[model samples]
Target: MSNKPLTYLAFIILVLGGGLLIGANTMPGDWYQSLAKPAFNPPNWVFAPVWSILYVLIGVVGARTWLAFRRSMAMRLWFAQLVLNFAWSPLFFGLRDPMSAMIVILGLLVSIIGFIAASWRQDRTAALLFLPYLAWIAFASALNAAILVLN
Candidate 1:
């Protein structure tokens, strides 16, 4: 097998598997259930499918960026966002600190935008792939803010 396929596979597994592990460990439990939520808060069932798709898209973008521009700003932003992405769940669900989670998510959103802007000239497809994830996270950021206000 060529290095390209292996790189894609490795990144997909890294992103998707890491997301699954973090999600499984940081599942919303009674603490989350007890907290007040915004009216627009999505149902529990909605998160899995949305995140699953986003993770794949993220993985693909990461792989493409790694292959084409390993040391570029886009790659750095990708790593930065992944760290923030992985941290949000634990901070919000495991530690049950919406305030800290909110901070991390804002940084995540910025890093995502940075990635898109950095990738736009070099790889439009990779940049486009991130649009849905951006929209979802933007919604999630609003939802997070609403939850903080409500509760």
Candidate 2:
């Protein structure tokens, strides 16, 4: 394998993280507190640390997958899911539309499944990397659905 620097991976993380922070900021105080949360709603503090790690994983796997394939269809799906993942922040936090956000999360979930399939078809590790992300989003989607139903 070539020894190309993984600088772009860090850049990807930075881009996703920056957008997440900005989106999270758009929510005013008590934004989460007032929501019709579920029994499994993670503690407020859990979000930042968890998301930080997840974002880094995302970037690394994405970079690895991209590097492995010069121009594969899976590579394109990887990006499509990334965009959808990034879009969730604004739809949920920035707009404060739980219902709309739920819908976005559904799309995000579907795209993630597609992305993982693409990742798995080419690179197993890349697919493995997204497992935690997929699990988390699945739980989050459940929470979103619950919130929408109760609220």
- In order, the Cα lDDT scores of the candidates are 0.95, 0.76
Tens digits of per-residue lDDT, candidate 2, 1-151, equal: 5544555556466656665776566653577577777788787788777878778788777777667774877677767777777777677777778888888888878877887887686788888988998999899899889988878
Q: Which ten residues in a row have the lowest lDDT in candidate 1?
A: 1-10
What are the clashing pairs of model 2? none
lDDT of 1 by residue, 1-151 (tens): 5799898889999999999999999999999999989888888999999998899899999999999999999999999999999999999999989999999999999999999999999999999999999999999999889889989
Best by lDDT: 1
RMSD of each: 0.7, 2.3
State the displacement of the C-alpha of residue 50, model 2, in Å, after optimal TM-score superposition: 0.8
lDDT of 1: 0.95
Tell me each candidate's TM-score.
0.98, 0.86
